[model samples]
Target chain A: MNPNRQKVLDATLQLLAQSGLSGAGLNDVIALSGASRGSLYHFFPDGKQQWVAEALQIYAEAFAEGCENAISKAPTVSQGIANVFLFAAKMMKARDFRSGCPVGAVVLDLDCDSEPMRVLCLSIMAQWQHRLAAHLTPLPEAKALALAKMIIACFEGAFMLARLERSTAPLTLAAEQMATLLEAQLATVSRSH
Target chain B: MNPNRQKVLDATLQLLAQSGLSGAGLNDVIALSGASRGSLYHFFPDGKQQWVAEALQIYAEAFAEGCENAISKAPTVSQGIANVFLFAAKMMKARDFRSGCPVGAVVLDLDCDSEPMRVLCLSIMAQWQHRLAAHLTPLPEAKALALAKMIIACFEGAFMLARLERSTAPLTLAAEQMATLLEAQLATVSRSH
Candidate 1:
């Protein structure tokens, strides 16, 4: 049961990264995961929506962890943001530009009226923003939050542009802008001292 | 006949803004447009893909025109970018946050394997970037293009974040960042002169 659940989640993420939520049919999910109808029904009685929530949750947690890890490990906050986007860019190129933000694909493709899914996507994105914000040391709380929101928006938007044009420039260019902003903020902190 | 064609395009854009490419089924298109099966095929002989292409073209051209109009009317390039986002923010809020970038929604939700669709999206985005770049009066060629691309990516990405979180903060924040960058660039150009 554990293996089946994990497999389903992983497959769902993969499918989402490639095509989107509505494009990811249930039959494809079951087929890709190799989970039987009986097991799927038993595990996900609420059906695909339940499975999707689980998958999104797992990915969202991992994304937050990644942000924390990236920030902690980097020498500077700007580099930290750059590292995250560069990693995403590399993954996208490796996938031949077929990959994108799973959260975004779901947000765009799913019915907008579905509050549960929207809330879930929003929370996941908020988790990422908060993780980034926590690392913007020396900046005011408001500034850090604003920068974090902009960074996430730019990077996620950059992913869409990158995948659309099949180029890494959009992501890398946004990262450069982010690094410059961080440097400017750091310089401000230094002047006060 | 002309009204029917216009209605179809309007409906297509509406649906794309709401649910994305795959989610906008043929029946929905027919049902929403109030156009008969005969008219849809008459207006779009190659079916939905062809219809999508037309809708996208109409959007892309209008998007480029908007950039031109915004930049030409604004007091400065930074203000131009801000005007675009502010207008978008108003529309998104008006739509209860259900509205999104039709190009972006399609890009994320559609199969990346579709070369035609990807090209269409890329072209549309490139047009916007180029339009912005052309207005960077004092900035050098390379810098102008880079700045324009980054601005476009950030603004476009901000829309996704805005819709997901159902707030205008991300869009407004990104626009603020763009304005700052533009101011900085202009200052640099002044110093050099």
Candidate 2:
């Protein structure tokens, strides 16, 4: 809530995106954020792990909100899915593929990390899925969950490819495929209704 | 080729899979591998970057071989696709979700890392896509590439989700979608022939 706390969180999240979790150390946070050690520790007394958790929470919340906006603004669910993919592609391209999903970069590095860290990562991921599925409420509950998860997987997958190959082709292709699937599902639902 | 060289390589990779690139340092490698510092530098004079490149090469080779084996053993391309996903699920489950794609963790953590690291990651990713598409030569080249990249993205993305959520649902769903897509494509090719 404090200005210093917000600055520290944003800096840490940016570091996570750029260099990942391990390198997003407390010193990096202090250096990048220009936040004094006193202010940083005052906000995050538990140090690096605590700082990471807070940063992850902030990023995840913003991501969830963005998904909701994308879903709501698109004319159709298929369009919504495509928009999400396209938006990610544009962002990655602009960043020269140097930036990636903060959550994803951190999550990959979490395999042998602490329990608190794992829980934070898992809960954020689960929250993201729930948010995406919420936009698909028109579909059956079971179907919505499956579809949302698949779409999320494709989104995650697209980013990985785009980052590696330094091209947006993979993301574009994923968008097309997801759009097709969404159209087919929506058609079936419409016919049934 | 040396036993100690192999041990050190394996330990670094395991560290990469678990703690990611930044944390998979010389110290972590030495500790996890129980290989002497002298042996590590002896095998890798250029230090961490060289060691990581060797580990990446090993993982890429194993991954390519796995792809070849899966393609050879399956009766159909669609089934081969499913097998890959199923195998990933099994491996993740066995490891209690502690193990992930070694290449993936490194790739994500690569935004601010060295140029050599990015090249190795990109080359390996590109190689995997080419290998998968090779198994789908029946499809038009463009289509095959698109499909293969999509499948790879799904696989990479699935592991990300599986590790984060500590469940195989994302991977399982991705496998189902990919299998269905592959089956439809193969049917079209058969009809055209």
Candidate 3:
């Protein structure tokens, strides 16, 4: 990616995290990226749709990779899930809680105006669910898939609460509860085995 | 309230749930409500801000009340929580999955453009936590509060997933998992006692 184009997408993503799709106007992108209108138009001739789509794809992929790495490296699924929440908390504090998952922000809104973007959001969620379930080895596939759904749902909800309250308490509690849930599942599996 | 005023507020809320804050434009409200521009202004002299605030208050309060009713009528905390999730699932299906919590929709966007509205959202969440905690008798207050927070977080997150996936599977999973967690907590409490 050209430096200017990368800068533009990064800025758009920041805006999307902080203010959502409607807030990532072209002018806001140009201003934040310090890129000229001519440059932005040159890179994203299709305008806001392309900018948002590309930026969200970058963000979602990186997020998925981070979760995968965390899960793959951990000794247990519970710890891996806890580490993911920890990373999310650190990111929130670093951004002063002004940011959230850009994909989540987009999903909360029904007016993303582009069918492809909506599909992208749905695909991102499905990918997250699949990747997380893959790490929960030994669990039946259906159980793993269901657990993965609960984990992601709790995570997204905790992130929203943390942002709204400007405190990471919800994230902390969610992390603990998720750990408990995962441990229970593990215990049940071990007992059965 | 006059029929026209009520119509306008209802329309605004529908738009808020479907498309979020930006999508609930005055023109959209007028068109949906069949209220004239003059009547809209007459009902909401302060315009969109007042309209959104009042509409959200109605929606949030009603939602809270419905949860309270479910909780109060259930045989156990786990069942009560499950009922709340069931109600949420039903609402999503009724709305054809196009609607979500209006408050969640607004919170996802940082550009709500009104400090009071932000404060109102914060208060609404606090009220939910407080009300849910109050229902949790026999548990230590701190534990109750923490559990309440986790429950609300899961509910919001599951609702978002259900909307995006256009399926209630996430909500179903969350409800089941929450019942498990709550049952575990109860077991611990009984053992400690």
The per-candidate count of clashes, in order, stands at 1, 0, 0
In order, the TM-score of chain B in each prediction is 0.94, 0.95, 0.96
Error of 3 at A85 (Å): 0.9
Q: What TM-score does prediction 2 earn?
A: 0.94
Provide the TM-score for each candidate, comma-separated: 0.95, 0.94, 0.97
Give the per-residue lDDT of model 1 (tens digit) for A45-125.
Answer: 998788888888888888888777887799887888888888788888998887888888898886666888888888888
Q: Give the DockQ-based CAPRI class for model 3.
A: medium
Candidate 1 vs 2: which has more lDDT: 2
The residue-by-residue lDDT of candidate 2 on A1-193, one tens digit each, is 7888889988998888876777688788999899999998898899988888888888888878877788789998789879889988898889887777888878887746377888888788777777888888778988888888888888887887787788999899999888877776777788998
List ranges where model 2 is wrong by over 4 Å: A111-113, A188-193, B186-193
Model 1 chain A weakest 10-residue run by lDDT: A181-190
Q: Taking the candidates in order, what DockQ does each have?
A: 0.76, 0.71, 0.74
Score residue A143 of candidate 3 by CA lDDT.
98
Which candidate number has the best lDDT?
3
Which residue pairs show collisions in model 2? none
lDDT of 3 by residue, B1-193 (tens): 7998899889999999888888898899989999999998987899888999999999889988999999889999889989999889988999888888889888887553556777888898889999988887767899999999999999999999998898999998899999999889878888898
- At residue B48, what lDDT does model 1 achieve? 83
